[model samples]
Target: MKPTEEDNKIINNRRDFIKTTAIAAAAFMIVPRHVLGRGFVAPSDRLSIAGIGVGGKGKSDIAMFAKSGRADISFLCDVDTRRAAESVKAFPKAKYYKDWREMLDKEHKNFDAVSVSTPDHNHAVQCLGAMQLGKHVFVQKPMAHDIYEARIMTQAAEKYKVVTQMGNQGASNDGTRILKEWYEAGLIGDVHTVHAWTDRPVWPQGISWSINKANVPNELDWDLWLGTAPYKEYVNKLVPFNWRGWWDYGTGALGDMGCHLLEAPFSVLNLKYAKDVQCSVGSVYVDEFQRGYFPESCPPSSHVTLTFPKTEKTNGDIAVHWMDGGIQPVRPAELGDKEIFGDGGSGTLFTGTKGKMMCDTYGLNPRLIPLSKNENLNVTQKYKRVIDGADGHYKQWVDACIAGYGKQELSSPFEIAGPLTEALLIANLAIRGYDLKIDELGEDVYPGRSAKLLWDNDSMRITNFDEVNQFVKREYREGWKSITL
Candidate 1:
């Protein structure tokens, strides 16, 4: 896709700003070292971050960046004042705004980077808007709400020449590197099947939207909160949380936990976009005789299977099973009956030609099945460990932003996070497809439930099932902009 006229203007403005900043830096560099005060850091050496969604996880994200001591929280934006109260108090000097568009419009020149921890639906637009202004971005995962958005965000990161990091902090964990080393060492041979399960939905799902509308909270800007999503009347208790169960604003269990659970497999197996997907979801009944049909809400539970083309590390195709809503795969026979499966709550299991291995969420506590194998296992540490593992994830991005694009390696840059997120969203297509209804001879039938969806990654579409294609790239609310290349 070609850049729009507005895009060209933004690009040109960013280039001019860079040129001006470079000249200023050059002049400053010529000053004598003796003239400067002791312990003075150059303005260019520190990263100024503008945070969007500065509350809840957003609040913590910015806090971690501030903790790096290299990042200055210069601006904060959140639609809900109540949710943002803690962050606002924490960063008293940071400029605050309810609308992110206004913050970026007026203050883009002041910040060196942007941190986005908004709802899944708003991630792509916020991140892209920052990148267009030549600002590096650290966005929460899944990187985008839909597959198409993920692709665009990944491409935009490179096109704009900005450092990017997805908020899958687990990517920086030592466990991921350990798994990669073990896989490369042929300890588990060739992994052919993988199962990742999560006990999620901890929020409501498989339900209908409330019929009664509630008064909008005094502290929240409802419209801004719904950016990129269709406008809806205010519903009780939907702000601080609960949006995860709805399709319009969240990507359900996959968006919430898939990145954390799947990052290790992606890193170890060199997995990219999925080739095909199929799924079976648990159903809810409205009554004893009738099943509930609430398409807007994600199912209570789902087991999705995604197939990937063979990679260099794999002998053939690979099947990845994703289970959510407390459903889990059968425990491997290698595991003793008394042994806990996947940290008890949620975990990932890898089945290989030679053996099986497993890890808890965030890829922690990885071990070969039978427990005994891990005792004597010794694999050379090939990948350098992050300074503080998961805790370092925020600092890694902060440091990289200060170092400039392409100067440092990130654990979950858009190139990696995009494809990983896309694969997860594609699996969601099957889950959503399961509920698609078609009228045949006046009787409703779900053809999508029985068909395996074929994916054409290049086109970002489901080749066989057209109904689900609507979700590949969702339509934003009338005034909200859609992501463009």
Candidate 2:
């Protein structure tokens, strides 16, 4: 059955076209398949995973996920295609998608897990959507943009029967465990007030809100980028990095740095809830004519005082004071006077009725006050666990994941972590609203201040302030509903 020369040429051309077309289709659809692996590794199954947002902190998250040789990452989603493309160098065989909604719809059920490293506003929606489809989730710190969203996430994670982890990587640190143990042992003796601080002098610290509204870029889908936040025009300062200080995109200095700074104290003291929170702000950082660094919508520098009610519920009542942006606390002059009192880097100072202990946030190293040769004041106990010198926190997560889905303990479970986050977030809320006051108890405690921000947990809406309250949970732009447990 030898073919004629003309027939042979025609067949060859047709075959080449089919081959090229198949390759192109795989390039598009293979994101999930490539990222999730055709079949998960047996018994000790390899997790099929995808990454959303691969720039800035997202890039570091990608690297962390990569460390887990047990997982296969085939799909990389990023609004900035350039950033997404750069990520492919690590997993060349993986696929890429610019829009997560498209990927989720077209490639649903492909992945066993998802890494959500998007902005604060986008975290809940994306994480909820992923978990809705029976997928495991690993989200970045400060789990949600607001208290209500954090509560929703907590409930959803429980309902889904899926594994969830927050990005408070420090929670897994052996030092944190040791601190918790120390508290149980009553080493610090009923820590009454905790002073947490940070020297986060990152770029545009005070100048974050000075963005000049401009036309959206061709590369950025500014509409989609806005996500749940109200439709607003693109501004130069709003994008990339400085969004951390803005009320719409972020929770200001406290939300920006509080999760990390307050971890040690929250962990050691088990600060559950605050009975009352009173905040006062110093002079706004402004020009001669009182031109604030940010718009009138934002807070310049604030000092907040949170008082936890006394109860027979384990430990005694405690007070936590948060100081940021060069606004130090008005406390025991002994601390204000000493240079050590105002060390002010990212850390926590535990002022007990007896002595004080200060620990640098992530470094896990603490020292008792009076730098003089006082050997008796040293914290004799040390963390004997391996987390002290482990390969970055991500490895701990992977090791836990490998031990089988639900068997491992999370570094920060929603039960304890959620409330601590609320305490810090409340500080951000108070900073933005003037004359804000929450009384000893009652839903309408902060009267004459801002309108009551009550949550319709069912709808994820704040009853007051129609304009901004809608931000609680954003309407996903088509094919992007949240993943409910």
Against the unseen true structure, what C-alpha lDDT does each candidate score?
A: 0.92, 0.65
* Model 1 segments more than 4 A misplaced: 1-41
TM-score of every model versus the real structure: 0.92, 0.76
Candidate 1 achieves a global lDDT of 0.92
Question: What is candidate 1's lDDT per residue for 1-62, written digit by digit as tens?
Answer: 99999999999999999999999998788665457877555666789999999989999999
Tens digit per residue, CA lDDT, model 2, 1-485: 89999999999999999999999997765455446667544434566778888777777786777765577776888887655556777777767887777878778777777788777878888888887777777877777887677877887777876677777776666656556555555555667888776655353444533357677767777766777766666777466776676656676677667777787777676666665555665445455677443433445566777776554423667778887766654444444355554345556777776566666665266555543423654445544454533234565556555665567766665666677677776565555444333466555343424343333434544345334443444454554455344
Tell me the lDDT of candidate 2: 0.65
Best by TM-score: 1
Off by over 4 Å in 2: 1-43, 201-211, 282-297, 310-315, 330-344, 371-392, 435-485
**For residue 461, what is the lDDT in candidate 2?**
41
Q: For model 1, which pairs clash?
A: none
